[model samples]
Target: MPLAVGPYGQSQPSCFVKMGFVMGCAVGMAAGALFGTFSCLRIGMRSRELMGGIGKTMMQSGGTFSTYMAIGMDIRC
Candidate 1:
């Protein structure tokens, strides 16, 4: 197969494409984790105001579990 010419008519290596793909995935993972953390904090606050200590703890645990699951999807992603 012939190499594709880049914008400046130079041969472009596919490694840059691979690097960009990896970077995109890392950014996506970080965004998901950050959003999950924010959601967990919000849910924790609400649960604390509406329930007892045990209930609050349970909510926090659930939130953490979900966040972990999302972050753990890196390989699948």
Candidate 2:
């Protein structure tokens, strides 16, 4: 059951989409942070570059994850 109808017959499909997006974003950001840190270190990035690289990596990963997650959950529903 993807949805639970209310007494008034309202369907709230956004709930599942939101849930997937939030969860995926969190997971992706964490993974990105870990991998980005190691990658930047391996590349011998200075402190300034390290922070910027990590931030960029995190945003890219988060967006990718969230988009796929939202679409997947929507399809599952």
Candidate 3:
């Protein structure tokens, strides 16, 4: 038996290349989202720990902003 070429006939190599590209893109997006969420949660936890015992005195005094900035800068690098 002989197979005839159709309108969309192509070689196997092209299909494999396309599949590899699609899979790579999906994996990269998933990894990036996971890391981004983890980093955000870490930042939130750090902020909460810093603001723990001080209560109203420090909140009204505006020292919280400095603590947050310091933590954020450390996380950036």
Candidate 4:
């Protein structure tokens, strides 16, 4: 197969790491949202606190998962 060329005409590696990061972020955010919502509800959190907690959980989980997935993909490559 021919190598992929970038806009500057330089050969570029495949997008496996990028894809892994995106997929991991999406999955992690979804999981986080579900768990965060339930945990907040169980704790009786309301309004701003509930929303803030969930958002924080989602961001942390997404970033953590994406970083790990990207590293794994880089290693595989």
Candidate 5:
């Protein structure tokens, strides 16, 4: 009483393999695009402009606040 039969009532391996392959690819792409804590820190650290004192602080704070605002106001917590 299963619904996974091929044209001749044979169980189709390709059907399940295609579904698993699609899911695996989606998961792999998602994992690759994930930006976690260390990634955030690295992007922040590397984005500092070569300006000294207030200029440097301005650049860093701009990035920090941009990220904060982008992820902040939309949060429901």
Candidate 6:
């Protein structure tokens, strides 16, 4: 007996679609779990350094802002 093909000339069963969906969900969940763990560790380790760097950046920004304000005041006078 000859096999019948669908419109695309391929005979794919419904099981294949269900299996693919289940596998996709499993893979996505696994990846999300791994990434969440990694992100937690990454942030925990860098939190102190991040705060220090932010403080330094704020100081530098303040100095630059004061300089620009002075320049504007001089231009106005």
Clash totals for all candidate models:
0, 0, 0, 0, 0, 0
- Winner on TM-score between 1 and 3 is 1
Choose 1 or 3, whichever is better by lDDT: 1
Instruction: Indicate the worst ten consecutive residues by lDDT in candidate 3.
Output: 53-62
TM-score of every model versus the real structure:
0.37, 0.80, 0.36, 0.79, 0.32, 0.38
Between candidates 3 and 4, the one scoring higher on TM-score is 4
Q: Which stretches of candidate 4 lie over 4 Å from their true place?
A: 1-14
TM-score of 3: 0.36
The TM-score that candidate 1 achieves is 0.37
What digit string (tens of lDDT, one per residue) describes model 6 on residues 1-77?
Answer: 34546898896434434444445445444554455446545667367665554445444444454445445444543
Give me the candidate number with maximum lDDT: 4
Residue-level lDDT tens digits of model 5 in 1-77 = 24567798786544444444445444443443343324545556434332233343444444554445444432522
Arrange candidates, best TM-score first. Answer: 2, 4, 6, 1, 3, 5
Model 1: per-residue lDDT, tens digit, 1-77?
45778999997645444454555555555555565556656667445453454444444555555445454443344
User: How many clashes does the backbone of model 2 have?
Assistant: 0
Q: Whole-model lDDT, candidate 4? A: 0.89
Candidate 2, poorest ten consecutive residues by summed lDDT: 1-10
**Which residue pairs of candidate 2 clash?**
none
Cα shift from native, residue 50, model 1 (Å)? 18
Better of 4 and 6 by TM-score: 4
Best by TM-score: 2
Worst 10 residues of 6 by lDDT: 12-21
Q: Give candidates' CA RMSD values in order.
A: 11.5, 3.6, 18.9, 2.4, 15.8, 24.8
Q: What's model 1's lDDT at 58?
A: 49
Q: Determine the backbone clash count of candidate 3.
A: 0
